[model samples]
Target: MSVRELIVLGSASAVPTKTRNHNGYLLRWDGHGLLFDPGEGTQRQMTHAGVTASDLTWLCVTHFHGDHCLGVPGIVQRIARDGVAHRVDAAYPESGTVYWRRLRHAAAFHDTEVIREQPVSGEATRLDTGDAPFTLTARRLDHYVEAYGYRLEEPDGVTMLPAELAARGVRGPLVRRLQEDGAVTAPDGRTVTLEECSVRRPGQKVAFVMDTGLCPAVYELADGADLLIIESTFLDEDEPLALERKHLTAGQAAAAAAAGGVRHLVLTHLSERYGDADEERFLRQAAARFSGEITLVHDLDRVPVPRRRAVVRPRPAE
Candidate 1:
């Protein structure tokens, strides 16, 4: 089935290196393709990663930093060039509308005119797509610029148990009716209720936090998320630089993930000075702070969302 994974197109922080391009990530959530922070060369990076313009459904910019949003013009133009008929929603800080306009038309081809401007205003607010089952929201983060983090949370659903239905003599289309109507009469003339055959299943949740220092919203966005993609711009040795630049060290990011109860942490936006081989240091730093799964996001890396934990909240008391 349903595909849920993140595709890292680029993972460099502040500057691009020979190997790392810039900050760019794509979260493939079923029918949704949320592209985050299309920095320079993101178009080429996407091509290398086997991601296409047609794959994008939303473009989210964390801030106006060039390394974070420079590829906006290219992304908009390429999607239009490929004749993307569907409207793509673009979200960014509302105060940066001028910069957005500059990037939107940096170089105009035939404008598809399908890009919806869903800007994030002051404070944390929902960017209601009115389509996806999960609610999408952006919360302001602590950074040198106006940056925001994104989160998606699906509502809890009922998981029907076949054994429970069979014991109740609910079979065939009657079971479907019971699910849809929450109750139905089987051929045995007994009323079967959906609650008797189903258990509550907690919905999956994921969050993206980038280009920010230690902040309250970082934990807010990552709170109880199944997967969290966050910026780890420097190692602890560079804590001074991180604080000066309003960026997070690997340890800080991992601590935030741990505090937020994130199941999987994918660390990105690494400094180019750190080699791929040196990535293990970041991993070890995160491991020291968080017990859950940790990843050092690299170019073209794909991280699948962790499976939902089965909820037993309403189980009958022993």
Candidate 2:
């Protein structure tokens, strides 16, 4: 079975605490594992999470913050040392070209794995991830530094209904033919249309929004996201500080999730000031605004993408 989950490597913002590291996340999606915002100790965190450089297919950085991309050198070298067979894609804001280069080549290795450079520039647009099964889009976020948020969208497909098979007397290769051709001539010499049996299965979407204050881009990235992982660097009590630092508070993150119709909200990149004792307070603040599932991520915590929307079961054909 395929597994899709977001592993929280580190969850601290600005400062690392005894309980939390700087910032890091690994989003595991069917055959593709995305490493996002890999902080200073991300490599070790990955070791703890039972993941390795071999599991990384994409390295995504929201910006050039030390806590967000400092682990690039280690990750790159680790993959090189392990001789990762497939190509890995490193996607980040184009404005950080200088910083990216510095980290990419921070140390030299045999460099067996081919890491593709996919820099995000200009207005928000869908990035080219090279034959990826899903679409990867990015939007510029409002932050003190040049930053961007990313969204993943799977393609819509048709779900075949089992009851419809009996009704239409279509089975085996005929069913596949109906799906492929949208219409098929059955063994009984009857023409069947794909729509008569299947219903549209809307694709699933997941978004990542980090290190940005409340902005249109935040909502855009979160819109209809089945799972949205965003930075809630402060609590409502520190709204002014959050605004000054270009970070969102828990309440703001929840409000954006509600406004964007997000189904699952994960608030991370917490401030060191809020310890275990304050975790409930952050969740409560967000719960007051968003009715969906909320998770205040902890280091090494793995949160799966909620199951895809149920497939519609159309009535059997007469």
Candidate 3:
């Protein structure tokens, strides 16, 4: 079975608390594993979460904040130490090239050439990931510093209906041929079209929005996403502070998710000021706006992407 989930390594915002570390998230989508953020203690946190350097296929940094990129050096060195041969694409804001370079080579043990620097520039850019299963796009966000949000979208395809195929007398190799060729000669000497036997299946989508305030890009990234992992750094009471710091309050994040039609909202990057007791407040604030499934994550929590929406098509007139 194909696995799709998000593993939370750390969920703290600017400061690390006794329970929460800094920001780190690993999104597992089929064959690809995207490591997002990777703050101070991410290396050790990965061990606790049972994630190795070899599991990472992409390193996505939303911005150059220390709490978001400080662990890049350790992760990079670990990749070299573990001798991970596969190419690891690192995507970050192009304006933060200096910060990225310094963190990438902070204390190199044996520099590995496997890491590919794919910087994000312009307002919105589609990343070239070379035959990746999904299309990855980055868009600029509203933040104090230069920041970007990422969205992964799979191409829309069709789901073969066994009943429809059986009715058309299309079986075995004919099914494959019909799917590939869009039409095939059925065993009954009739032409069966692919559209007649399949229903349109909208592809799954996952969005990552971190360290950004309310912005149009945030809505674009989260639009129609099956899973939306976004930062909810403050509660509604601290809206002023959140606005001043260019961070989203729980209500704002949930409003974005509601407007974007996100199915699963995994909120993280919480401020250290709020302890374990304040978690419910975050959930309440978000619940007031978004009716979808919401999760205020903790360190080492795993959130699965919601199952795909079903597409129903009526049978053609006989």
Candidate 4:
């Protein structure tokens, strides 16, 4: 069985507390893994989360903030140490090319894994390529520095129906024939169509928005997302501070999730001042606005994307 989940490595803001580290997240999607905002202690956090450098396929940085990207060097070095042969794509804001270069080569190691440095210079950049289920798109967000939010959307596909087979006397060879030919002629000369035996099922989508104040792009990228991982650095009471610092409060993040039709909202990037008491407040505020699943993420916690109901049709009658 395939698995898809977001592992929260660290969730603290600029300051780290006894409970929280910094900003680090590992999005595990089936065979691929996307590591985002690897903060200072991310290398150790990954161990606690049971993740290894070999599992990383992509390194995504919203900006060059030290708390958001300081662990890049350790991750790169570990990839070399483990001798991962597959290519790893690193995506970040183009304006921070100098910072990225410094962190990427912070320490020398055998360059076994080919690091594909993809800079997001403009809005709506497609960063990945392959026969993957979804396409990754990045959009600029409102931040003090250059920052971007990312969305992953899967392709739609047709779901086959077993009940429709028996109804049309389509069984055995006729099943394969109908699938290939779209229409199969029965023994009695009756024609069965593929359209009658299948239904189009839309694939799920996931988005990540961090280190940005509430903006239009945030809603755009999060629209209809099955899972939305957003930074909620402050509680509702601290909205003023959030706005001033170009960050998002819990209420704002939840409101954006509600506006975007997000099914599951995972809030991270918490301030250390509130501690355990803060999670309830954040959850209450979010639940008040968004009527979906909400998770106040903790360091090394794994949150899975809520799966949509699989399309099913009645099997064909005899």
Candidate with top TM-score is 3
Clashes counted in candidate 4 amount to: 11
CA lDDT, every prediction?
0.90, 0.90, 0.93, 0.88
By summed lDDT, which 10 consecutive residues of candidate 3 come out lowest? 307-316
Candidate 4 lDDT, 156-205, residue by residue in tens: 77677887778778899888888788899877788889989888777889
Clashes of each: 0, 0, 0, 11
Which of candidates 3 and 4 reaches a greater TM-score? 3
Q: Which wins on lDDT, candidate 1 or candidate 4?
A: 1
Best by lDDT: 3
Better of 2 and 3 by lDDT: 3
Q: Candidate 2, residues 1-318: lDDT per residue as tens digits?
A: 788999999999988999998888888888899898888999999999999888999999999999899989999999999889898988999999999999998976776548988999876977776777789998999998999999999888888888887888999998888889999887788898998888888788999999997888999999999999999988899999999989999999999999999999999999888779999999999999999999999999999998778577655599
Q: Estimate the TM-score of every prediction.
A: 0.96, 0.96, 0.98, 0.93
Local accuracy of candidate 1 as per-residue lDDT tens digits, 1-318? 689999999999888988788889999988789999999999998899898899899999989999999999999999889999888999999988999999999984888887899999888979968777788899999987899999988888888888888888898988788878999987788888888888888899999999887888998999999999999999999999999999999999999999999999999998877887878899999999999999887789999999877765365768
**Tens digits of lDDT, candidate 3, 1-318:** 788999999999999999999999999988799999999999999999999999999999999999999999999999999999999999999999999999988983989999999999989989997998899999999998999999999888899999989998999999999989999998779999998999999999999999987989999999999999999999999999999999999999999999999999999999988889999999999999999999999899999988877588876599
Candidate structures ordered by lDDT, highest first: 3, 1, 2, 4
Instruction: Show where candidate 3 strays beyond 4 Å.
Output: 315-318
lDDT measured at residue 304 in model 2 versus the true structure, 0 to 100: 90
